[model samples]
Target chain A: MAIREPIRTGGRSARVQQSIHRAVCELLATQPRESLTVPLIASHAGVTPSTIYRRWGDLPTLLADVSLERLRPDTAPADTGSLHGDLLAWAEQYVDELGSEPGRAMVRDFINSGAACQCSNLLRGQLQHITERALQRGEQAPAADLLVDQLAAPMVYRVVFSEQLPSTAQLKVWVARALAR
Target chain B: MAIREPIRTGGRSARVQQSIHRAVCELLATQPRESLTVPLIASHAGVTPSTIYRRWGDLPTLLADVSLERLRPDTAPADTGSLHGDLLAWAEQYVDELGSEPGRAMVRDFINSGAACQCSNLLRGQLQHITERALQRGEQAPAADLLVDQLAAPMVYRVVFSEQLPSTAQLKVWVARALAR
Candidate 1:
């Protein structure tokens, strides 16, 4: 499934890829991930199944690609002058994005299919940035791993298992407790 | 898919149900949950799909039943004389069970399929039992919900996303930290 030529990012092929990405997200918003198939995505995207296969190879790979492309460059958490504010802002955004119904479907698919994704690593790096800033200011920052374990993990567990999205206030309280130690 | 008579706790029917439950777990041990179908389970269990549908209603219900039954009565944590001891014992056991490869697969299935489960709630109740013991002793026990969010959630998130099972020692440290304040 290799392309004979280098597919330029500004080419027609790139435009098709963009359309396919949009189609996948749209389908995921209303449908269960397991029920999605290549043919279904191709039909929705106005491309041939062969085009999907040639570009993405498989559903899991395509799903990962779509997830990566969905993260815009400016979407990383902004520094909010304090570790507490930074943690709260990041957690709110993280919960809002990943705890949304559509995001849940994407996660369910990625996890159930046992697909390898860089999203976790990406998220960890983003978190570390905030912790680093706090350390520079001589504020006792909780370890990035600890924050992930105590704060991020519970929110994710609830989303996947109970389908309950935590409110910002609920998340802020948990973050405060984590930082208290 | 109604049963004509009450499901007998005794007789050939009981034995058949047991066999079906065993078959589901065996299949889960070796295969992906989404790939598992009623007919496949029936063939593996030496029963018919209608038998499964009639008795269990669907795969999610059957999966939940198998999970519930597979949890032996003695699997719950015992009172280990102190909150720290009890929490460690339970977290280690919980991680060893759910963080194992087969257990992760089962969780992935139950989660991805949007199945309702008593496992999470059951786990919370068990944790509360230990906290309740602490309360009776006039020891300050963190809220059961807080304990779960800080301790259990992180362990589960790691297992599901990183596929790395935390060591008993690591779990103890986290549990200690969570209980510190």
Candidate 2:
């Protein structure tokens, strides 16, 4: 399925969305996730609950919208001149970003929103880009799905389900395993 | 940390617990997850909301408790005469059980519950048991952690995040990959 896009992109509709998103972020910083409600967020954002309900449908969907916005990659993957170096650099950065407490919270929101595949696809696209670059350079590189299986899946599982995040050393092992013939 | 046990495991407390759990399962079968609230569950179970809150802490925790109860394996992994056959059979069954719609909902609850590590450890224990059995039979088996990293993680990531479930063919590939020298 195609990724869900914002219903409105400009003018007053965009401004309302921005304010609502900002309210959620601010509330999350101070309050526990369970305490958050559409009525509370609407009040904080100076809008009515009906407005939020009409636009976002529910709290999970709204949280998903906010999380996807935050998770969007702002820049391309780094160019390290080799597939091994590039994958290592990318995997290291990925772990550091997603392994953080707030990042894990975003993952929880994405998963609970029932739109987790959208986030997965975003991550997969970046891995595919990296592999394509390696293929262009005639350097050996693993398929993107293989990277998802060997590298991303384990890292995500650790971050979301395990008590400890995957260490940098573990990230190295995963990158090596993915690149291994 | 040890798994959380029931505050009271016998008599009236046990009866109340059973009633509450049954109510949750029944409600879940009929109502959307988002529509479920402690008060609603209490009304259905013929108890007070405070009783649930005092016992389970919150909705997510209660959901997690219900999910964990449903997820506990009733029997040991099948004995297939060889490590390869055993792993293959186990992975196939794992995908089938967890890939279903209801199973996926349970996974979302576990992830949102802040107690996901408990579930992961349970799965790890089962994998270790399988590996130990292989070792006893003098068959070479991959380490349990390796199986988790390669087989469990990929299957889980797909089940919880992606739209498509991993097929039996894919389970075989994961088993082969995990067992590869």
Candidate 3:
């Protein structure tokens, strides 16, 4: 009487899997940080824990995929034609993003398990690249990473520990101060 | 009669308890992070499991105090007559101390239990005071906390996450960059 949406027929199953995967990530984004366990993740995707466990094997593996899914590796480099301008733009973007609910939740999740997630490592790599780019442009400073760390650390601490987001004005002031160096 | 050190009391019972507490902390510092437990802590501390349980109530409380005892917050904030200089000096001293074996051990301990510590409220209060001081100096900006976060976060992160003591050059550069604004 009616044609049915194909169920579990190779390509069909892959498509369905893709759809469910996206939903799982979407749910993670929308939910509170504390509720991101396997049970919840499966429920959010309209699947069973067996399905999830079979697909990802463990929480860390699942988390690694979800967190890095939309994270393109192109953080603003230290070169908006000027080192200061570029760093400021990076700072502004970093601060604004971190101020949001999702960003705050992401930070808390990373900090909670004694930083068992690979997210910190990923973020640290991005920061390292930003510094390296400056070096490539012939800027020399021994404490560049320290300077960057100083500028970036507070937002994370506030997000993960204190549950507050950085204000835009504060972000600007911080960038202005760091660039002034 | 023997004169016992203040750390361990005269009576045999007191002596046993002192050895046990010290042993627990030492094990946490030296052993793999995964090996921490009531039994492990008690065994290392040279006391019975009952004594360890009775005193600490749980792994978290005992771990918390022992971890706190390991940090040396430089009491005398160096006054190089200016905020920038003082901060740099402080960063240098802190990083140097953090580079030591004991410092590393303490940091590892904290990183492992950071979630269980619940010190966010305390951190917020301290941030408030720092903000007030900045305002008093006629240098208040919207992102003052962010500025502070950037500066402090890197040091904490590097120690807890990377297992590397940030170089002095890094600290100096960071302070210089931060105060430039």
Candidate 4:
């Protein structure tokens, strides 16, 4: 007998969720987020509105779920052996993903929601993982919260205010400085 | 007999500008920014729409001008005896002003433009002034741009993302951390 994942409701549930996620992405690509509605998304996904409501409860929750689906990495970056390398790798991935239009929109939605959004928490978790690995290497690392403030805040600032993503070298300098002290 | 300021295009010009500026603030207090228009502001100010057009050219420009009018301090913070005092004072003032509703709206307008809005440049100039003052006191300060990244970026991140303005104590902690070698 095949072992089933604990969270899996079954194949049909998974398929419906996947279809809804795809429809949201397609609509987001062409339409302004403000114009997106449950009814519209349900029609495009070929599922009933009730299905969406039952699954996600509301639009913001659904969008947050979709954002996580698109953004969560398949697996955390392999341990790079040094804090600096791990941080640079993480920052580079962030710049690549959040620099895109869809990524940009997802972040804006998350930020505008005021209280910490699911995406911010997701990124925080990723930062925690990297910092834990750095500690495992016998390196004294800055606290994860401090790293997030220094690395993530500035980067997200550029994306939101200036619409310019920091270059890889810029990220490296910031990471190197933080790691050094 | 007396030397006069060249840019002070006196009397009627100043009066008209003041009226229009006052009207903008009054409307901004009661209405959503998106609903504001040149004609509405003109009528409220007792000026013609053509006059507003001739003066500021567009809504963004007018809003930016009004923001500066309200926000620009009469003088840069007088040189406090220490860099710590200077930075804390500056950050405190920043939190008080930008953390308010009007200031928040102005910043939102700047970010929504997705370009180098004047309000952003104005804030950068203010940051530059504070850093320059710190350097003048023979203190080793972080580069202004780096300071911008570390200091200004986090403050803005709190405002935009978390919607919680950093408390005065929080700003002081960040300033001290950045200023420390």
Return the top candidate by TM-score: 2
Q: Which residue pairs in model 4 clash with each other?
A: none
Q: lDDT of model 2 at residue A54?
A: 83
State residue A39's C-alpha deviation in candidate 4, in Å: 6.6
Give the clash count for model 4.
0
Off by over 4 Å in 4: A1-20, A29-43, A46-65, A113-116, B1-21, B30-65, B115-117
Between prediction 2 and prediction 4, the one with superior lDDT is 2
Q: Candidate 1's residue-wise lDDT over A7-86, tens digit each?
A: 57888988998899899989988887778899999999999999998877778768866765575346557778889999
Q: Which residue pairs does candidate 2 place in steric collision?
A: none
In model 3 chain A, the worst 10-residue window by lDDT is A1-10
TM-score of each: 0.80, 0.90, 0.52, 0.74
- The lDDT per prediction is 0.76, 0.86, 0.56, 0.74
Query: How many Å off is the CA of B175 in candidate 1?
Result: 1.4
DockQ for model 2 equals 0.78
Query: Order of candidates by TM-score, top first?
Result: 2, 1, 4, 3
Q: Point out where model 3 deviates above 4 Å.
A: A1-58, A70-105, A108-150, A161-163, B1-23, B42-62, B72-89, B96-151, B157-165, B178-181
Tell me the TM-score of chain B in each candidate.
0.75, 0.89, 0.56, 0.76
Instruction: Give the range of the ten consecutive residues with the poorest summed lDDT in model 4 chain B.
Output: B1-10
Query: Comparing 1 and 4 by DockQ, which wins?
Result: 1
Clashing pairs in 1: none
lDDT of 4 by residue, B1-181 (tens): 1111223557888889888889999998898887999999999999999998887767766776677667767888767787778777777778777778777667645543343334555667877887777788787767777767778788877776656778887787788778777
